[model samples]
Target: MLRVAVDRDGGVTLDDVADATREIDRVLEESDVMGELPFTLEVTSRGVDRPLTLPRHWRRNEDRLVKITLVEGGEVTGRIVASTEESATLDVDGDTREVLYADVAKALVQIEFNRKKKQNDSEDA
Candidate 1:
């Protein structure tokens, strides 16, 4: 089975996966990269469990909760308020903390099953 992990700034949608799969299938068929052997091609998004390593990854996860491990030795859990190429700003317990990418050993997005959605003005009325 061939598995392809797709990622985007905001997130990966079903349409994106479908488009990628079609393109990949076309390329493989044209190039005959897989020879005569039949195989399954599975395309999916980089799951929430995937570690945030790049600036883009951090940017993509903005507004999401994350658990970060510092290189110096410690952990922090907070919501990603903002991120730049060099660092990310997190809201931890109502306090904002800026953490440089160089200081981050690992970071993973946390899953919230019952997260409250931001209510729109129309919804408030």
Candidate 2:
């Protein structure tokens, strides 16, 4: 089975992953020469460590922390301030803002507070 992920209405919600995975499974079963059979499948949202390169990925992570590298060689690490079809606005410092897009050499979701807390708990335990 092929993996799939889709974010309808601009949100990478769990339902989005589920729907895409289901549809992909259906198509594969109907189209593939092999008859339908159980196969390993994994469908989930972008992880806390996932990179946000495409516009759809950015849309899914509208208000999360991210590190962005512009094609011009500038680097930005901050919260995702806003997003559009062409670019993403980031709140770098308290007042600074940078708009970047596919020209980005790299972009990744920054680890969040909750995730960090969980890590700490696991370590302590």
Highest-scoring model, TM-score: 1
Scored by Cα lDDT, where does model 1 land?
Answer: 0.92
Write one digit per residue (lDDT tens) for candidate 2, span 1-125: 54544444345666677787887767766786545566776676556576776777877786677887778897788877677888887777676575757588889887665644434456643
Q: Which regions of candidate 1 deviate over 4 angstroms?
A: 121-125
Report lDDT (Cα) of residue 7, candidate 1.
89
Candidates in order have lDDT scores of: 0.92, 0.70
Off by more than 4 A, model 2: 8-37, 114-125
lDDT of 1 by residue, 22-117 (tens): 999999889877889998999999889889999999988998999999999999999999999999999999999999999999999999987777
